[model samples]
Target: MTSNDAWWRGAVIYHVYPRSFQDTSGDGIGDLNGITQRLGHIAELGADAVWISPFVRSPMRDFGYDVLDYCDVDPMFGTLEDFHRLLDTAHKRDLKVLMDQVLSHTSSDHPWFLESRASRDNAKADWYVWADPRPDGSPPNNWLSVFGGSAWQWEPRRSQYYLHNFLREQPDLNFHNPSVRAAVLDVCRFWLEMGVDGFRLDVCAFYFHDPELKDNPPNPNRPSGKSFMFNPYSMQRHVNDIGQPENLAFLEELRGLCDAYSAVLLGELHETDAEKLHREYTAPGRLHLAYGYWLLGAEEIGAGDLYGLVRALGHEAHEGWPAWALENHDFMRAPSRLADGEAPMALTAALISMRGAFCFYQGAELGLPEANVPFERLADPYGREFYPAYPGRDGSRTPIPWNADAPHSGFSEVEPWLPIPAEHRALNAEDQGRLAGSVLARMRRFLNWRRTRPELRDGNMDMLDLPEPVFGFVRAREEDRLLCLFNLGDGPVDVDPPQTGFGTPVEGHGLDWASHAGRVRLPRGGGYFGELA
Candidate 1:
């Protein structure tokens, strides 16, 4: 599809965490060259595009999230020429590229922040959020950082407090400043000119905070059993600290800039009222799509829960598109998060069969579970602070196993930044690619199968009311309709066919379903797909 077709719509985008994808430079850390070398693997997986995590210049404090330079690549990843080669090679392979744009905050070492923190009278002084201390010499408000502790950091030079929604090294940018907005837009322009297809806006909701710096109210019902359960940041409703009204206007400006290049914009949103924010942020001239952690952060996955998520999004996301992801660099792997046996396989089918765009995380096709990283080997600050309880993201950020017998699982010639899990070696792409019924093979088949069926891609999905453990939906595009039924449980279950005309069962990627007397028998972790009569 051409860019004019808005290819992001109903696209299957693979997420690549550069540090773990592959390491060609022998630095034990994956880089742009590694990713470029692996583009063939992604193309072979049948993904339309790749959403690469941050590879910009950084101090590695928060990995690449704390960007020191937006326009340049870090030496760790490679040089600017390497990035250009990557972009060129990916496009030649018919794959679009989406870079991670950390517009919310920047490393304290960034030149902009350095100049801004120098003095209040400097040209870039107001580029970051700065506030005076309260009369008691405490923080201006009750804002809390997502990484734990106070959001406000004292700067002795200005004798003022600056806001940092994450680590103290990553200070929040002041979107209230028109110049800051223009500068960020210019950063986007630089990448667009360099041939990036689009960007995945990091912490898009945290762009503009409340102008008054008001205190956030406490949340009466804090969610339990989540990766962030121990985080005090979850205790508050976060009304004023994020999801500000000014963010919409700023997004419109960014959209205008992107529209000039026909580039897509995807937002990473976290809001108390996520559905509402998704609707507002993607309405009309805003972000092309917005996705929250409704599925990613769930401790349990149930049919009702999955149905409710889609139903809610269908209702709230009017005039806007939705993007769904089962696993990413930030969350636990789907196999470990979901049930054992065939449940992970079923969930993968369900994720790809959904109505909207899909973001398939790297190594997820191999059905890789969360790796068990020892406390001594942990490199994630978030996990270190809440160790044993949360275990941080290191478990999910381990290197991708390419070859089972190669040193470091073929990720690097030397030691990797994070140890490759032994379990992953058994599920390496090299081995799985040869197995007929492996998750990787199944994923390739399913994704390629999805491409031929318009009903599964850009079709209207209607949720079917089925019994427990069975979630059914019909994807229809004009006269073509496909019935999709999935059993989320481990035990075999029986489900009745829809009252509508039912055609013969369509061939699927090893998913078995037998129908007799209008009753369909679905094996555990099995699903059925057929054309509507």
Candidate 2:
């Protein structure tokens, strides 16, 4: 492949939350063999790559994000040999592998963290972020954990407070320390040497903290809706808590490591300024691409919102490539959040066909809704703490539905770690393997269709200024031009073309372009495309 064939650029990545992707071991949780078994399905869907959530050795405190061993695979997932098999199978199928690398923190059970926390002046004492508590016997500052409460955890042995932007079991690593950054880079090198194509850096923005340990000021107006909307943490502007400038230098260092092997890094920026930070982080010589939480939010999808997001990044930076995603391990599926369960196929078609590289979570292609788990079945600690209110991420992390007729949707012979929704049984891969009109079939069709259009693969977007809820954009590269339109609302929308120079419906969804009286009628939650003469 040539430099222009930088596969990460404009390539669709399928995010397989490993624990939910497949369970070939029949162990109730997804594992490496399970992923190997599903590679064909991913390749068939037209995805050029796969981003598997952390399969590294973990205590499962934060469900694999809290890494216990960077160089080894957890037994729950499988051995390192199993991962090699998955990687080999994926590459054999011409698909790249982008694995998760959680840099911000590590599980308390990790050897490094354990050694660091063992004593005040141990060999790895400064490896993690540790600070002296205030004289008042309180946490060092007002910084809050994303999981909830103060970001500091008191360690009695050291008689100090340690910073943890997430669960207390997951302590934030001090990237400000050069040695710590070097060790993390070594971890990256370990995987890249193993032929891993790239990385999805978890909490890419939350790597550093204020040395002064200042307080985060309160946000005068907090955003509402979904889980965190009601939480007080939303009320405070998380300035000192995360998105520190010290992170950029470390990112540059990591980029240097990745560049040595031509490995791509998609930094996952989970912050208030995610889009802005995404632009800053992905600028040349920094990150290959940057994705944030905007697409995962519960905001209603609209033509205007989608167009605005693309335009925002377009205006924000010129050189940095943008990567977009609608669903992932942490968020509910798009169909469930959009309330467009009525026409999810059309919605998925519109989403994947947009102007940038997009990601589809496991089970998303099947149009799976968020499975509601009762309090007794909940496994996430965050959910347990805020029960009956903000249920945790387990709802979206259930097992993949493979066979409709098999018990537990054929995810496993044993009971799944989380309950599989009965509705998902009808939408399994086996049910759609040979049929049209199924969401799985539609995903395969749209992804394949999307790859054939070079204009879409690598082009600039010219958003059409049409009526409300009608998303319109012209994907243009060199001489090729394709007008893509979408009806993101629940009513029919009419698009009066500037002129009838549309030669034909180029991408071929079998729509009648001759009847397009220069005025195209789009059904509720539907989309269409046309090629200019």
Candidate 3:
């Protein structure tokens, strides 16, 4: 696998949120040194790579998402020397390192943004998205930021409004500006030269906005049942604000740059028609893989829903590849969101069996549910702005519990940036590592088993048409086939045998099924895997 050029195809990549992973400096914040020390856990867990969230220099307003410097590591995380050492150590463990690249935006304090906002005639004045006020001194268009309120922020120095899809401090970069594109590409080159295996592009779709600055029409599907419905941002069609066709050309240019170093590109696309966008963004000479908010933001986890999403994406992404993640930094944990009795371990098994590369968020293997954070302890700006309605992402970004008895669960010497959940203390990694049938143990077993099975790793997947509560799929690679069946419901489900013959059951940890006279009964949170004849 290390020798393969397309190692990311069907690979399992672990996402390490630096702030929650570990804190070696005793400053109540996780840093590069902590991640370097924990690379062994990821390697032993059978992950091919690790995708680290932003640790670049930032103002901490939006955490590391608001970058002030692209080439330097934040002092909070470590020095540039520390990052080089971390990268070297990770590679020694046979783990590829992927850094988070927030190319679309930069902090208001960033030199580029400061210079751009200083005066209208400055050399970098056009570096960021800026426009004059409308006739009534209002915003140029009806673009709303994801964090709430208007996307345009008033810059008194230039008497112009700058576009900020997220926090006001994080202004969107103007990719239409050739110099800005070159500067961003140079940032990529600097990290590549420093030995980053790849990058996880943040807000990939918001890179290029409509050149004409036309107003976005109101969303016809008002009161859409999706999350963040309380905010007006969801009520707009966003046709003019994002997902511009010009983004494809820029992505191709970015892809060409990455190809020079043999690095992979994974994009995080946000759009209503994500499947269509994923197809266009990942076509040849662009992103190697693109994952959208379909699974991450989905409220329903039924068999039909999972099957439809995977099938639709498979059909839409012609020559491109897809990556799947049940949970990430932005979403709540699977156990908290899933139905009662549907074990997080079961969901982990189901995710690994899917026909694409997998990204497992940190602490997910511990069966960690969403934590309860007091209003006073909230740190997420998004949550603060939409309080009561949306408590923000702080609950999901709590520190990882390493020891059950240690103060702050061995995350920090002092209190952490976010409160550690009492429930997670009982499910710490130290204790779970020694217990069989634990979520962590199950994840280790399944990931190790998945590595040996070519069908599950990079083979063709065919969804089985089983009855409700029973979702089954078959992964095949030429002469070999592995059949996977999962029970998404809480109670037991009796399922008829598939038309295709099933071979002897293959052991996958404790996942088992009872077959009697062509009828199989699966217990709650149960899964079965067998060789297909």
Candidate 4:
């Protein structure tokens, strides 16, 4: 493969939640054209690619997650032509476009489900996860939905129940069926033939289930953190319901199909043991890159945990690569989660400097904290159920604030599906783009400057043994080696450089830095990027 063919390795992908990106139709929702119009914004931010979330035909029961048709765009988002235009525009900007594929499940309203539930036997009857009652008329197992209660919903026509890891409206597909796999692969071909760069496989681990249908063991350590506390779903270890061994073969098959088209595949892994699963899932023939919620859903993120995670990733030399994301549509913004009192810009520098590929969530460049959406306006079903306790993801999924002074914050002529908070408006891209110290400005400057450093791309990353709250690492390849240190603490800290030796400061990375007498001073949330002398 040529250097350009392996574009996903260490690539910076910009995540776009199309529903909240921009509204070209003025229908209170964002569309493909809106994303095309905003491509320049992402390009200016220096991302290598764009991973647009689901915009496929759907009932919107789970807001495009419950895909009804994978082959076509929903009218609300735009026609297939609009997607073609969006893709063309992105490529023209040198941005690779990756479509989000929710192959694990389909909307209950999907034609496949509609037929599968029609009778005990049909052509597509086994296309979804369906099982008979356990004599007492209860669900097949003790599996629970990630969104709320029982993962099964009884279908009276066949006196059976179907599994749904999320909302019941989103029925889990039965990958155990060969024809089902082929159909989904055909869906992938449809898009690749249409010229998409690749796919961001949604809930990739949930593709297969235990054929015997055993009950998942109770989660011994009740989950708690910024992510899983609100739901009962966190109570189980998820043994039989997901992360099955059969998934590896299916992923390899998917990889084969992707390889034929010279496309890349990124998988989202949901597992308690992320580091272990990350290795298994991304190994040689499986996913090109994979990421779990280890960092995104952490109870508390500190330098120690960050150091451990990077080391565990085996950045020294590993076949399977990993991806990083501080925030996405489903989680609270990074500033609200990890910033504490630190500048969001510093977090940006620290993450982008890491060895693996990275995902830059839309609106994060402006350092926007989670918006405070009122309960009266909540739209996410998962969030609505656990409202006051766990605000779901509505806050992070709100519309981007493009212009501070424009009505509706320049997201649309009509009010957006989700409101743009005043706080976000204050940090709008138009205004932040003009400020030198703003997170947006710093992110752009650093990203562009980092682009010139070849070692950062294919370098061997070694985690530096530094003091707590002052994480350090080195990226080296051949003759070039760069020393990167980040102050993840609250106040300024003066610490000795890594005993191996801190190099001469390399300027132009756009951070206020100081180094002298082999000791470096980093202000709150500031970082240092230097060339190893």
**C-alpha root-mean-square deviation, each candidate:** 1.6, 2.0, 1.7, 1.5
Model 3 lDDT per residue over 198-286, tens place: 99999889999998899988878653333557688878887887899999999999999999999999999885668888878878899
Q: Which stretches of candidate 3 lie over 4 Å from their true place?
A: 1-3, 222-226, 315-318, 341-343
Give the alpha carbon lDDT tens digit for every residue of 139-235 in model 1.
9999999888999999999999999999999999999999998899999999999989999999899999998999999999786665668788889
Pairs that collide in candidate 1 are none
Largest lDDT belongs to which candidate? 1
List residue ranges in candidate 4 displaced over 4 A: 339-343
TM-score of each: 0.97, 0.95, 0.97, 0.97
Cα lDDT tens digits, model 4, 51-129, are 9999999989888999988999999999999999999999999999999999999999999999999997899899999
Candidate 2 lDDT tens digits, 1-533: 11344777678999998887778777889899999988999999889899999999888988898888999999999999999998999999999999899988999998888899999899999988899988999987888888888888999989998988889999998877788888888999999999999999888888888778789898875765574574677888877878888878888988888888889998888647667787778877888888877768655766677777776676222557777787887776666666555434555566566655777788877878888888899998878877777888888888888998787888888898999888877788998878887777767877887788877766766766777776677777777778877777777777677443444666455222224556777776556788875
lDDT against true structure, model 4: 0.86
Better of 2 and 3 by lDDT: 3
Q: Cα lDDT of all candidates, in order?
A: 0.87, 0.79, 0.85, 0.86
The number of the candidate with the highest TM-score is 4
Tell me which residue pairs clash in candidate 2.
none
